[model samples]
Target chain A: MLSPGIMGRSLLDKVWDLHTVRELPSGQTQLFIGLHLIHEVTSPQAFAALRDAGGAAAGPPGHHAGGAAAGPLGHKAGLRVRRPDRTFATVDHIIPTDSQARPLGDALAEEMLQHLERNCAEHGIAFFGPGSGKQGIVHVIGPELGLTQPGMTIACGDSHTSTHGAFGAVAFGIGTSQVRDVLATQCLAMARPRVRRIDVAGKLSPGVYAKDVILAIIRRLGVKGGIGYAYEYGGPVIDAMTLEERMTVCNMSIEGGARCGYINPDEATFAYLRGREFAPQGEAFERAVQWWRGIASDPDAVYDDRIELDGARLAPTVTFGITPGQSVGVDEPIPSPADVPADERAGIEEALAFMALEPGKPITGTPIDVAFIGSCTNGRISDLREAARVAQLGTVAPGVRTFVVPGSQEVQRQAEAEGLPAVFRAAGFDWREPGCSMCLAMNPDKLRGRELCASTSNRNFKGRQGSPTGRTLLMSPAMVAAAAIRGHVVDVREEL
Target chain B: MSSEAKVERVEGRGCVLRGDDIDTDRIIPARFLRCVTFDGIGAHAFEDDRLQAKGNHALDDPRFAGASILLVGRNFGCGSSREHAPQALWRFGFQAFVGESFAEIFFGNCVAMGLPCVTLPRAELTRLMDSVDLDPQQRLVLDLASGTITSKLGTQAIAMPDGARRQLLEGAWDATAVLLAGGDAIDATADSLPYVRGFAA
Candidate 1:
């Protein structure tokens, strides 16, 4: 039985307590899910398995309907497919943000997009397609449309689904099989992760945006720092940030090894939700706000572990090596192999060789072949507006290919209405439509061999940009804009 | 079923390639991620620029031909949480991966699929890679029993940490073994606790 103190409480506690199907012997809470988001990339197999089970269940009358159906339900009866209303679909990858026309350039990509559309339609599930102005990167579209809100538990096939945590929701990414499970059943039996508070104090520097702050956190905590933990970002810096900025920080929580990152719902959060597409309205909105407020952690709420950092001390950061954690401040020198710890020396050497970079060299003068300002991490209108501020002041350098992809069609329309695209195009950037372009190189956007790019997206892993040897220098949107104009890695703070 | 089922085991001298922050996309590109099965992904593993040079194809280069054990630098398999990476490596006939470190999800995926991801110091991996470069046929025995990978030049013991060694040794990929291990306790708990269903019909 659940205790009253733990049940029917704050949004986090309510969702957490309600989802506790059981406690495993490993001391992990087997929490259930309320909703699951699926994309084309990860759903093929899980759908196959479900179809297979459905077929097997349709064979004999009693055997199929009773005992065998139970077999397909797994050991837990609570883990059966229930509500399709709570499930949703979206096509983000493989769809060219620039063009929403049918018959995508890549045939297989087109087939997959069509297949997802058909699947969602046949199942009576809602799908946001390319033609849908509301369609965008799954993560970007969810919160903007108010489909994702406080107290809801959201799971997506993509890892960055943790971005929903910005709304005080418990969201994380799962595999395709888990996606299938959620599709068939509105609930997912998952182990609960310990919570850690990443409290950032002080103020942020002018040129340093959310991307730099996240990169700085990953650098300090290492790539595996948040293993098996949910990071709750709190304190002065987060409280002072806007909802979009908070989403940007929580978006890369997975990069630092945390399952999810979140900020407690506040007035800024409620205000952002107000008048949105799916957010509650009138009396219901007020009720929702009151509940959301109650979910904010109590004054003495305890955390399993806590880490604090001075946000003002953070600089315009860029990833020097392959991983997000392998980074340095914009003004800092590339780490020499000798200066690296004994365990990390090999990595430094390999990164230097793969990137063709000299150790102890300044990162500022390093040339770049491309500059991409897009993806769920920093493709919002605010991010574009900031990048455009830089683009309006200077023209892109010759021989540098730059792209400014908006996060969604709405953001695209908003940016164009504000003439942000004109500014970018005038500065030599190709203003593209909204989708996860060049982020993981799922679409047509990719880097050529040995090409180095200053990117606003998350993850600088080797070959993460499509070409195995293509180097990614992760930086803020402004820094990417600066690099695009200078055709090299330049500090945005200098321009500022 | 016979007690002695045909289990194919490939053994080789582990060649350690050490580098930091090797992500899943580097292990297997997103292009190869759409496949439903793990078949033939091994050949395309590291298909991007790693196997190719500027204006040249890496497959034509004989240096990487028949290289089994891939020694990688720190934070190996860091990026996306795609299980396709290990599947691709397995299909490519890589018996084991020796790294200084691994991303958590990638490490878990490898263990679930019965792939041995052994972690060692950066120095040891560098020395192992150097030895492999010197002598391609150098014998490196990966003893699954002891969880130790030994090269004729040197020996370094690696840790699996999560008792994943047993799963690899048994060649079981499904979560059934874990559930079976806890079956007794689960049954006892289920017997004592009343079932309370909570979803709306």
Candidate 2:
């Protein structure tokens, strides 16, 4: 890497610089938003806010989609927004994972979905409604359709939007107000975060997946440690990961208290985006690939802070507490409060009580009532293949409820194509369709009273899996599969 | 930079909530996230836990009821990117907060919503919380312009980032204003993007 004063720049800097429209008097940059990905949960209030401000959604400056007449451009009408093409909506977070049936059983969920659908329609924006074959978790489908690209600034109302940064884009999770800002102006006013380069070198051991890698990082850096910084994940391990694997790592950057985490674009990135649905075509595609590769950090780029880690020494890990920071290797014993920092003692106590676990007990045999393997973090094809491989090795433990929810219809289709769904079903796991699923548990799939679940989804906070008293342990999909086989949290290292 | 009327001060009873790393999950549970609008979310703030604990949770305690100023421990609102957390607190009648520290997202969300989250040193934070705890009726005043929090017991200067403090004091945290102010440039930028095209193209 470059010395502190060297001029070589990273992709994060280039993307940020390219997107900087102007610096406002408030010292926040007026950053042009290249992409706005919305979902059922966060866009309704924003759209309503737009309309309340006496502004209508405007199409691209001089153009209209679907013959919908364009409104006054930008924020001209006290609250106008331009560029419908830049905004895309998908029905996720609150959609039913079991079926595409209309008017879902949950009235609130159905209402949110309807609002999202209507808002997108009235705005002349694209909506990937359920059964459209494109509807899925917003993060999953963005990259699936090649909407996420290098050198762009992407914003989503959900925290996992950092997943898009795997393409070398500068992406962030904004609150509802900021979502409205992007909708009304195609830009956001925000201070830039310092860059923290986290280097996880050495090759990953078998069964120690990207989920483990990210979890390990979050464990090393306290959940709040990344505050005010953008994480630039690099080193041999990151470079060796596939596009989807990289997405998994970047997906939980928010869990680390970092707004965004990114990997430098390389041959691997362009190869994944090549010929995909929204990716450039023919000569255009080649030209785009060149631009993508060029955005990679120079060999001698600098960072505000650097952390080094070794991936090869890691084991399949699982969270034993509420926050993602309380993770430990599957083979390790649950840590006692005494073993933790004084600041974290209370959290450990609370988590141990909430999860109904003792401090010194090993998590390996910690009984689990459910196994949920899905979320933007790990519901992609490679994640499914790893889980499926383990499913083929054993059957779901008796009385254990196992659900394999795909991240998207596209992922579901690919999983089915590879016969992974059959493998899951044969092992007594309910192979379900797409959406956020039990990750956030807005849909039908949820935990019952005080049930402990091994989940591949992020965030194991109390009630995160739907039941207020239910417990969740965050782990890799393969670990979840192994847990399903054993009826408890287990090490995928041996099972795989 | 903003057309919003500047805020100079706020005065109210103080409600103390002591706990570090009290995350958004405790602030507003996910099950309550289904509304098209954030209405009545305050009632459900700390929903499940409030119910489970026989109504002893901070948001449920009668001591903090209807109190507009909240005093909390370190790392308050540390999980999830849900704006509902602040919306719930806003609906719960909390106008300002004094804390040891705050999660970046929660702090940013509060500032954007015209809610001030000012930090105090740990010793001073304890004094603030203790004073609030000693008398639920204790009145506190937050002067945004002066960066001071005054209570019947004492007065202390709060530490806030200059950027956030400016917005809070100016009432300029209204992002809509900034967004609208840049309308022409925003439109021009949109016009230049290849992906941003008229359907007719």
Candidate 3:
């Protein structure tokens, strides 16, 4: 019974309507994907399924006649892999950043990498490998190379694929099978999420970054607050942010329980795309910009729900527990079990036990054994520059292992050209290549048992850092740099 | 057509596990997430830590051999929106998930693929996991027909959100079922709505 002329529609509604294939009886829309990104970690099985189905169709009369011929044939094909052009593959999770040598040290890692390389080549899909200059974290390369743009629907196997939303795209992470489905059909049937507007008015304080804004938002809204909603981040603060800073905020949208988060395309967005590699040339670019401008939410846009935040009131924040929502300001004390909500009390207690922290204690002085400043979430050149600025000021504490990993080869090269790597090395930190180093521990960078680390990555779930008992303290990259310098979780603002 | 289509029942005893924030990587590591076939994923589910643990064999562990339902603690399936987590559970013979809560993407994917996820009180989940741990052979029954979860030790009725429950009962995914449910009314609405024409292209 809804009217079509709902005066002002948000960007989410505009994109949703434009891409919706049809409305079904279930009230969900069948959405067509514009872009699908795959990685080694999630697509091999899908291709195999496609081949098995094709093989079944092309079999000879006696192919299935004998016992030996049919002896436990490990195959079934329901997936189609014909549309390789719609899919792109990248090596991130399992590739070690320290070495560009041919054979990866871990046999399993090497096998996965090789499988992806072979599969992409066999299917005619473009792949960004370790040696490829374009190679970096899947999320980073897409935007930096102008592959991700306004009004497109992008999907990837990795969760942070939502990072593409900063470019005014509707992006979400999918599972392996879903990745396969997109590889086959370049479409997915998805239920449209209700739109929520998160308005952050006013200017941010000096030294506060996009990471601080997102952490503050997550802290206010419980980790599960945005369930079933697509968040539209707007107002003065969001409008003023650079494209990369906006990406950092939207990248962690999943952590705040939103399906995805985005800002409307504006002059900043158009300017960011103006000179990028894959951006449309000359007149085409101007026409594309017009279309993009039309899609931005009107001044009087309506949303199912709206929440307003004051940007000036926020400060650099850090998580005290396993969940991203379990965070406090850098200067604040960790909440005691009694202070937690009744529904979350048990989880809080469990996190406390696992982290071995006392309630009401300040996290600022908590000792750390390791400091990691890289991940798809916060491993860009700006993040590196911020950390390097801190590193250049002081040396890493003795006995503390510090690693500074850029998000991509381009980021590494750019940092090296800026002498950021030298700054890190002088501060006693290991400056490494890209490829998701120490983020999820698929590579050599991992925490030993019971080692406490100040990490800039997204998740801090038990055993997430490789060792079952390893403890991770989630913080901003600058905070991690400060922690590395002091061998403890020190407030970066105080150090500044 | 007669309503005599044979229904395949996915039935088995449930093995309960209690843990918070069990990520997709833990359910099925990114390494094992590659294959297209759902087959054998069940065997390798939880391969990373479960197989690496001393004196433990996750695949051969009889306690979870044929479990059709999983009872878990808060924030089940929290990290990563990897669809393989639910696919692995489905392949492992789990038809239903009982937890205090679920990650949004995990819950959405489960619903789309016909995997039933039920949320109950944390106390109920704690009790269920405790009982199952005490007796490995304890059997739990999840009745989608009645919207109830019962075990030899206790029974708890669950309330699924109206939309999702209806979707499951009708065995419908995507928007086709919604339109079909509305039948002539949807057609009439579509005809009346002029803006629908703008979206056609």
Candidate 4:
């Protein structure tokens, strides 16, 4: 094993060095951001901040006397997007999936969307609004459009911006003020985090998924364990995962308290990016692959720490608490406060009380009132297909309301063309339009009072599904499908 | 935009919220984030948690109602990068934070807003929280230059990354101005990366 602080440089260091604009006086890096994705919910305040400050693109002018001729310099009259070509906007968090109509039912949502539209138009950035056939969760459409390429530094106001790290990018979620910084300067003042290599080897058990793999990792590492570190996932299991599967794992990196997580770019990554809307064409793509391959971490790369897990032993996982870390195998029992150490017992007791769950009781057979199968975490075509396969097995249980929302308009279009929506409808699931429907529940899709939902979204935080007292159990889409059919939290393996 | 805007010191009464991983959802629920602006968000800080506790929660308690310094447990802002969490807290009158630790994004958000979030050891934070609870009106002072938090109870050293400390002390925490000052370097770096030009470069 290589010693820490040795010669080997990890992929993060390579990308960090490449993106370095300069080191700031504050001892932080002023790193250039390559791509910026924005959504309606978190961007209004950011744009408002920029405008209020009278900030211009790429600084207050005169910073660069003879910079690139095309740079947006000396536009001090108003706040403009510094790199409009690299910035993309979409309306997701507050958009209703049931209807894409203007004058949205929620007046505030309509106002927020209009602000985004006006901001994008005013700044010359691309706005993938409703009916654009390009709108979806910012994270979802970025990869689908091939905009989230490897070796890039992507930023968004949304916390799940880490989802882009699946392509080997050094992407991290930023706050609204940081979002304003990215728009005005095309750079961020950031302190780099140490990298931890989380290796999961061996084949996954049947019905176990990328979602389960991440859940198990969070379960072992605790939610805040990854703080001050970026997680680099590898091993044979990660090597074999499709890009979408890798995305699902990376999407919830925030749930584990890691601001960013990534997998090295490999053949699967290059293959997925080839010929996509924003990816390089023919010969350039081959060159891009060569560059991407060289950016992967060296074999002897040194890491701050390492953790190993066996994928084969992992079972279908579900969160029974307010946090993603408080999870158990579907067939496992909810943790009793007595079984936990005194310091940890309070968190478990609090979660159990808020979730209205009985300690020491099995999580399976816990009745659910709603089943949600969507989010940036698992709303892609592949996830929908997996759920649809299970949907064919049985009708949704009586009194259970189930929803299967695609991640993007593209995902929705592809699934519709493949007849997957009909399959979900036939099984008593409501097929909705794309947006971050019910994930954070900014839209109309929300859980009613005390309702328990088997969800495929990332966070299981209290009130995450839009009801102050609503309960969410984070699981994979197929598991959600099985639960919707049984009206309870059942292992998908059993139904299969 | 000015060096005078730097947050060198914060001195005021302290409010304590005891819990680890007290997430952003619990701080300011998503429903309150629908507004186009962050105005009037102070009324909703810990909105649900306060409602659930029914005046028993720290934010709702009369003693802590006007507190300016917040002392919290480890991982105090663990989920979601919604700046609304800190915005709500800031609007609710919190000027400085002392905790065992804070989640990465939340810490960055607080820093960007010119709010200093310093950390102490678990025992020290517990002692500090207890001190504030015992005397709710006691004023605590945090000096970023000295890296110490002091009160009538005593004084304890706090820790934060040197970079963040410098940023806070120099009033460079609102990073847009600093980042914009590097426009030439930014363009040069972007030009050097092959991927920036779609590998055609």
* DockQ of each candidate, alpha-carbon based: 0.20, 0.45, 0.20, 0.71
Listed in order, each prediction's TM-score against the native is 0.82, 0.94, 0.85, 0.97
Residue A135, model 2: Cα distance from true site in angstroms: 1.0
Q: Could you give me the TM-score of model 1 versus the true structure?
A: 0.82
Error of 3 at A78 (Å): 7.5
Residue-level lDDT of model 4, residues B104-179, one tens digit each, is: 9999999998899999998888888888889998889999999999987688999999999999888888787788
Per-residue lDDT of A1-496 in model 4, one digit per residue for the tens?
7675677878899999999999999999999999999999888888776666643333445554212232355544445667889999998899998989889999989999889999888778999999798999899999999999999999999889999999999998998999998987788999888999999999998799999999999999998999989999999899989999999999888888897999999999999998899999989999999999999999988899999999999999999999999999988899999988787888999999999999989999999999999899999999999999999999999999988899999999999999999999999999999999998888999999899999999988888898989999999999999999999999899889
Candidate 2 global lDDT = 0.83
Q: Which stretches of candidate 4 lie above 4 Å from their native place?
A: A1-6, A55-76, B1-3
- Model 2, range A116-174, lDDT digits (tens) per residue? 87778777899888869998899999999999988789998888899999999899888
Candidate ordering by TM-score (highest first)? 4, 2, 3, 1
* Better-scoring candidate (DockQ), 1 or 2: 2
Residue pairs that clash (backbone atoms under 3 angstroms), model 2: A2-A300
Superposed by TM-score, candidate 2 places the C-alpha of residue A201 at a distance from the truth, in angstroms, of 1.1
Return whichever of 3 and 4 wins on TM-score.
4
lDDT of 2 by residue, B1-201 (tens): 133656567789888887777788778877788888988888887787788989777777788777898888877887777899999988988888889888877887887788888899988989888878888887899987788898866789988877777776666787666655665666666565443432112
Interface RMSD of each: 6.6, 4.8, 8.8, 2.3
Task: Name the runs in model 3 displaced over 4 angstroms.
Answer: A1-5, A24-27, A55-82, B1-10, B28-66, B87-93, B108-114, B120-201
